[model samples]
Target chain A: MIEGRYFYPHATRFVAARASAASGMLRVEALDGSLLNEAPAKSLRLSPALGRLPARLSLGDGSHFESDDRAGIESLRRELKLRAPGGLLHRIERSWRGITLAVLATAALSYGFVAFGVPFIARKLAEATPPSIAVAMSRQTMQILDGRALAPSALKPKDRARLEALFRKVSAHEPRGAGGYTLLMRRGPGVGANAFALPDGSVVVTDALYALAKNDEEIEGVLAHEMSHVNHAHGLQRVYQASMIPAAIALLTGDVSQVSQMATVLPGILVQSAYSRNFEQQADDDAAAILRAMGAKPSRLGDLLLRLEEVHCHKGGCAPSWLGSHPETAARVERLRQETGK
Target chain B: MSGEHEAAVESGAARSYPFQFEGTGGEYFGIWIVNLALTVVTLGIYSAWATVRTRRYFRGNMVLAGHAFDYHASPVRILIGRAIAFVLLLGYNISLNFSPYALLVWIPAFLIAVPWLIVSSLRFNARNTSYRNVRFNFTGTLGGAAKAYIFWPLIAMLSGGFLMPLARRVRDYYHINNHSFGGRPFETEFTGWQIYSRFLIAFAMWIALMVAFFTFIAVSAKFMPHGKAVSPNDIAIMAPLILMIAFLEIGFIVVGIATMAMIYNLALGHTVLDGRHRLRCRLNPLVLAWVVITNTLLTLATLGLFYPWAQVRYTRYFLGRMALEATSDLDEFTSEAFGTQSAVGEEIAGFFDLGIGL
Candidate 1:
């Protein structure tokens, strides 16, 4: 028997009581063994076990019985052949060995999800995004760039036309062919000697990169890389990838305000993590294939990368970065050149 | 203890009962990690149950007078609420990226929904809590909530923030005054100028901190030798100034906490139940800040495994300072609450991170 207090239906006042389920019925009695009420064991409900607190059992008439006997409740449920609610979870919570294993499993699962699951999910999301949404998003990006980082093209008309011919040749070699992509030339003093693509198949080629390229093949190599970015929708993919980690963190932490500190670390992690390297590698591989399809050497793209690296690293310091970093450049260059052997 | 019970019965008045927290860090750590692991394995589908179990653990461990409090929210209801909230949140995040018109639609919709969310969430949480079988209740209306949460803040900003503390006072008043237990209202009364004074002091500390910073910079520049490397003598002069500035920065944060504690104390201190029994709070700002900062740092260092310990420590220390001055043996009450409130409002409010905690 468990000694506790019994409350009448919806009443606050309670009396000293002894509770038992030994007779296949939940029985409560005054201390002298006088019956207060009795019900079938299957008809009663037990609250979940929480720490070392008293367990509450409801008698379905709004009357409840409370006792600090977890083991009694466990045995009572067992004898009645009744399933205890939250039984497994509470056992896991109460065991040290179970907790340790849980911590290990949590760590492994989180790392696996963030490292592989997020990228795969990001790819699916990018592919599923509607073209109109992509167009609108790209328009906003171009507007922001124009307001801050981009200006009118300063290339001579002759240089621009020759570059247009190279672009057309690369576009023809792409799976979507000529109409699938478009190119724009602009002077970006801030972004100096750089090229990038938006989600809507618009590739921006800064004029300084034109001045930097030694030959048409080198420029075509750069176009091929940017076109690959367009074909795979990598820009949109990065946006989705960046948001996934914070979303997952919020979900696991109950999306509460107390975890705002974790949110602040997202921008730094998203901008500088290995996910960017994977995107760059994907685009590079595709660009190498496009180069080989155009009957040109893939190493021409590597040559431009090294040339761009010289301009950047010489100005400041030679620290490898997200793109064309000193050490990563050697690996990327060797990979692209190996495409030639195939 | 028997003699003391007889004495309490004889007087039937003016006795104080200190709130006690009996939970230990070691036990809570086990429960918290297990909860988190299950939540993750289910991809957050089990988080509603986790939240319920965690809250129940803390509530059942809190002792008031002689009886422990209890939380009785159903996890299945909370799960349904969260699923709906998740869909809405996902929609909001996606539309925010895909459509520029989203803000124009979302802002007004959210603003209109704020009062309902606050009222529903407060009522739901209050009705789930019980002491001695008598559940607490909230009877505040949406109009009252809007006046407190939206109207007061906007008016405060229009007054150029000189009246922001008054806005806080109104909000605390709205929260405390509308709550009832056993159908008797709880009331809190405090003047706006009292909170304003607290804000003024914190602001003064901030200004003093900036002045000290500028003074340190000037002193450092004055002691530096012209057009030459700084010597050890110069270093000694700069080091004391650096130390002073570091102290001032810490003081700035402590002063902010002091302001928070003042408001906290003022709100709880003036609160009364049944027009006789009074609630009192005496949180030390220095201790509060120490616990808060150390908890944050430790939680970060341990990658969140220290969370349960941090929570236990805070509850044990802070609740020890809370007390109820009773008028009787604390037994003459009846449960008056059984309203079935949907949990969606609270789930949505959590999605917005409204921080409506009391």
Candidate 2:
């Protein structure tokens, strides 16, 4: 028997009553021994018991019973042979060890998903994306940059042609050949030597970058790195991976304030840096291979990278480019120097 | 028994009934962590069900006048909505990456859909909530939703923020006046002037904090020895002071919380249910701010393990500050049959992080 409240169908009127499921019937009675309700026990539907909250029994006629005594309610359900949905889940919730395992597993799964699953999925998606879309994205980006910062190249016609010829050589080595690849030269007035590959294989190199290079070997090496970026469609893959961030954050803390989530910014940056770091390393290795194929020492690329960094910074340290940054830049240079020895 | 029952009737003198939340942080944590783990393990396929469980748990623990509230949304319905929302989100993200001009398409599409979505979400939540076998409901129309969520806010912004207080009043009225308990309406009323007063106070507080922050920073900088490297002693002394100053800089949150509390108190205090019982909210803004900011800091510090506790704490404090001023027996309401609402609007609103405007 459970002492609880019994409500009539579709009514807020409730009687403080005692209910008992005995034999094949359930009966609810007031304290005066007058019966309030009676139904076949099997007809009752039990709301899942959660925490120490009240458990409710629906009589299917909209009449229901509610009791705070969870044990009494569970026993009543058992006697009636009724299933309590979410019963298994609540039982696990009530156990400390289960909760502990849940926490650890959640952490592991989230980390594994972000670190491996996102990258793998994004790479597949990037590969599947049509080339027309990439071309549009690249064109829009370059147009915006042109209006905002980039100017027409100031390089002599001879120098521009020579660089374009080297760019074609690297493009020819790619499986797609040189048909789609193009060398876009622009002068960045205030911004120092810069170079980057767009999704549609437009490698934009600033005039200062060409001026900063010591020799043709250095220029060829950098061109190979940019070609690798274009060949692998790294820009599109980065965008796809970036698009997963807000969704992941929404899942984790759907209702949390932005202030509290501010703490996640550093970790989020670290994850992104980790991604770009891997890409930088791959481009470095690919550049090394291409330089060897061109019969030039890989150290020429390393020397030019160090010189570019020096030109980038007038004070403390040159801001790291998307291609490479400090510690990582040092590591890539060291690897290229090793390639030279071999 | 009839004589005793008759004697239990009130003489129209109001009595206050406080809402009690009986959930413990530890117990809720167990449920929360497990829900999150399952959602992750299933690769987000189970989030719809998880959301329902979490909402049910919260509703079940809130007791008013010895009866607990209940939430009864079907997980299957929610799952269908979530699947649609996920696809839409992926489409939006992909198109945006494909071209910035995608905004030209999405922004208008979203604006047109938002009114219907807001109304649907409100109706869905209300229809799923019940007390003593009688359901709560919202009878808001899309026209009302558009007026409150879109047109009013637009007018306020276009008016150089001068009409914001009026917009808040209109929005709150739209939310509160549309709600029904067991087929009886709840109506709320407040003057634009009242909200404007609160806004003024908030603005003043923000300005004061900005001044205080700069003053504190300048004072601290003054105390540092000029032309000398800081010693270990100074570093130790200044570190905690700097941390404290930085924490107080979340002062913006203080003003924001206070303004929210003020609005809540005004809206709830003036609310009348079936034109009989009244609702009251007496939140002291400073104290609520302290609780909220501290809760946020702790959640951040613990990397969100304290989230369940923070939610429980917030519920306890919020409900503790509310009371139902009843002038008669509270059991005469009857439910009206309403069709179940699809979860599409609710799920899409949630996906976009839209608050329910309540």
Candidate 3:
């Protein structure tokens, strides 16, 4: 026997002698032969045993009657059927395509802005600044600093020797054209424990940072990482672009009006900015290569990263202000671990 | 009985619409609200389970031409796919900065990862089955599923602003053409202008209401009596001030309801279809008004006890009144278990666990 349940229409007769259009306490039933009395009638249900069947029920005067006119009922029943489960899969499939298209569209749109919009804006900004005044201002500032009676003339003999040794160690296995490397150790007002690399190939490691290092290797790791930035020419590129281009524009365009404004914001534009993650990775790779070439363990970098992480804990994963343009200590540590397979 | 007699009985049954729809103990709404709440609370983890529950309910209860519906989704596949996507996104971001040129490679890699997900979902869903007296069939392709990704961003972007109407049109178009069953095809079309105009009017109304509300607030504050010292005149004026404030509150409630109605009407459009069966989507103004008023009072009075009931009532009214026209010989089945109270606990639990809407 082909066993199947059929939902039969429930017959409702209003006991009220008056024919009222209002429907209250309607009765309904399930295909499984379960009766639901005085239930609100929102949807009709029918379960069939064999082929398709269609019939409509009439509602009027507090009475419900099934009509032979199954045309409307069948269509309505079909409409009410639950959407197939495959529809979800179908939606997912469509979503995948939609995501791909969206990604491409976003890329295209961003590329358009970067390639066209940025250049246009740059040109406009350049047109607003003159080059000569910017050059003179920078030159004058350098002269003023140079003429300062408080500025130390040159490093002490022992400090010079140490700086020379550090430079040699950092540049020993540096990749060609990665970046030019320089080391500057000078005595001035104590700036706390800090180390920084300027865009002009100048790496300043304060005496306080040297005091904090557990050993020379940790210091070497720091120098190697900074050397990688130099070898990559990132520092020079940033400095040249930041200083000269704007200055040149200012001088050429004869617009020193925004020069003061630019000067005020320049430190923010230059300092403690983040390099791209990819750049960080590349620098990590470069540093790793340098350490390998110098016959030193790459784990030294990872160790330094951990120490830095502890130091920068309160800064929400950011490096200290001196190392602002660098990756967070946690990221640096992770990258080193990944590279060294430790 | 002979096969022919069996066929006749099935055919007859398939054609009957006798107000015989079953109630799944309000599990539908329970699950919906639960999932919605869970999604809100859990920050969307409950969505996966919610999706499964939704599929189970719809599959278990649906009857068409005497046939039931079946659905399936693999949690493992979904989880794994999500993990892989997350990892890839992380890697892609890293690659983007170090070598901006590397984005070229990442783009294609991202594209390739998508089809695996689409195919897995399709295979799992199609294999799930339901049958009445007749055999049920499920058919779909990877290409169809993959197309979804193409439109989703457009939908997202369009939904954000004046482009909502265009977005709705695209959504309607995609939804209509994306299904097929029993050798029959389903399709729908919506004009962009219709959606756009509706949204514009709704936005305008919202803006006007906001303006009026602020104006009333400003005017009331300005007119409120202020004096150097507390006196009989100042005390006497407080009664009218309180009344005016009460009146303003009522006005805000009315305006809020009107805004919700306008938004609902604009976003969903007024028509929906399951295959060739077309249903005119009508927003019952009266029902909407009751819901708005009742919801406002409930929220104000009980601090929110009546929220669930309000939700159930509105959902019921909307789902119940939607009428579908029959265009084919197959029996149509409708289910309305919107206001029943089954699985509410599960839903609430899921909502809390998922931290859904936050």
* Most DockQ-accurate candidate: 2
TM-score of each: 0.82, 0.86, 0.34
| lDDT (CA) per prediction | 0.77, 0.78, 0.45
Model 3: per-residue lDDT, tens digit, A1-99?
Answer: 111222222211112111111143233333343542222334332322111122222232222323223344343334444123333322332354533
Model 1 local distance difference test score = 0.77
Worst 10 residues of 2 chain A by lDDT: A318-327
How do the residues A224-318 of candidate 2 rate in per-residue lDDT, one tens digit apiece? 88888888888998888777765565555444353445555655666676787777778888888888987889989899888876665443343
Write the residue-wise lDDT of candidate 1 on B1-358 in tens digits.
Answer: 7588547536855778899999999889888888888888898887787878877888899998778988877666667666655565666666676556677888787777778768876877787777776667787888999899999999999999888998999899899999877566799997767777878877887788788778878887886668875543344754776588768766776776677777888899888887767788999877987876677667777877787888899889778989988764466533322221211121222232222222
**What DockQ would you assign to candidate 3?**
0.02
State iRMS for model 1: 5.4
Interface RMSD of each: 5.4, 4.9, 24.0
In model 1, residue pairs whose N, Cα or C atoms come closer than 3 Å (at least 3 residues apart or on different chains), thus clashing, are none
**Candidate 1 CAPRI assessment class:** acceptable
Candidate numbers, best DockQ first, in rank order:
2, 1, 3
**Model 1 C-alpha lDDT per residue in residues A274-329, reported as the tens digit of each score:** 77777778888888888888788888889988888778655544534543212378
Candidate 1 vs 3: which has more lDDT: 1
